[model samples]
Target: MKFEILQFPLAKSAYGGIILPMEEENKSEIFQSPTQYESRLSRPKNQFAPKKIFIILFSIVIVGLIIFGTTRFFAGGKSEQNSEPAPTAEAFPTDIPEPTEEISPTQEPKKPTPTKIPTPKPTVNPVDKTTGLDRSNLSIHVLNGSGAGRASKKASDFLESLGYNVIQIGNAENFNYEKTTIQIKSAKEEFLSLLKKDLSSNYSLGTTSADLASDSRPDTIVIVGKE
Candidate 1:
């Protein structure tokens, strides 16, 4: 620190035309007070601090508002979806009428029942050609001409055992035959051979006649005599 002294006319006029030298710092002190200078220097710093604080508060408010708006928007959309109605099943009708069948006006007449013509049942004659010469179809009448008791009956039983249909057994008109005689109806003449075959083992065969009428009920007549 050095000091330099200078004098101005205003100082000279005040000091009676004598010039004086003064330091630059002392001149500056003479123009401004220390309190005013100190206050002026701190003013920019105070204003800058308040501006930064204001900016931070404004950013925080803006972020909070944006977050609130976004949250509200999503919440409102979810509420709308939840509030919509769900679909339901349809109900069945209960009072439907039953269908009816219709009858026609012009029905056809019923056909008359066909008359059952009684077909003549086939007559199953015992001596038909179909039943040719079996013993069961040969009706026999035995007569004992041997004057022996039960001779005709024994002949009749023997013929029946051979499957001949023996219709009667009795004594003949006369006991004069000495051997067996066979008489057969012409309608049953086909059975003569079979009867001879059956009686040949038991009695000697005598005269044989095939002249009996066709209407005779017995197909054969036999007269038994002494063996």
Candidate 2:
């Protein structure tokens, strides 16, 4: 009888030998030789393969850890240097001045006293240019032609008050005179302006005659009028 070959490959036994079909167990055409099986089974087990792989992985892990530790150490040292505090300026003590006392003022300059001025007295005895005599020494006569009572006496008193010597007071020949007249010797004409200035305050002067008859007693004559 002829048996058919199996479609799948043969499996291995627990002892590492080929597990063939019982029909092919003695078939020399399909079975391997004992020496060939022995040759395959007798091959040396690679005992150092797992150990070499484990050692290579362990070396890689150890190299990574060393690199990581070195980087951490250097980074930590740099951070510590950067975190250090900067130096600050030192303080010094200041010198404070002590309080001083104020002094009072003394010995001020004195003020000067004002000087007094003297007042001058008026001249009462001015000299007359015409008579070559002082006004108080010249003789004057006052006559009233105004028909007013005591007009000549009033004029005589007024002339006397001005330092003239009024020797007489009387009435004129006619009382029809309109304005006062001043009659004097032609030599005494220089005194006319001064006498007019004095008499103009109380009398209105009219005709003034300096051609007196030269034999007249008084130096000047004042004839009082109604005006």
Whole-model Cα lDDT of every candidate shown, in order: 0.82, 0.84
- For residues 71-175, could you state the per-residue lDDT of candidate 2 as single tens digits? 999999999999999899888998888988655577555679888777654546656555555677567889999999999999987887778889999999999
Worst 10 residues of 1 by lDDT: 122-131
In model 2, which residue pairs have backbone atoms overlapping below 3 Å? none
- Give all TM-scores, in the order shown: 0.42, 0.42
What TM value does model 2 have? 0.42
The residue-by-residue lDDT of candidate 1 on 90-185, one tens digit each, is 999899789976656686656899999998645333332543656787889999999998999999878777677899999999989999999999
- Residue runs of model 1 more than 4 Å from their true location after superposition: 1-132
The residue-level lDDT of candidate 2 at 101 comes to 62
Output the TM-score of candidate 1.
0.42
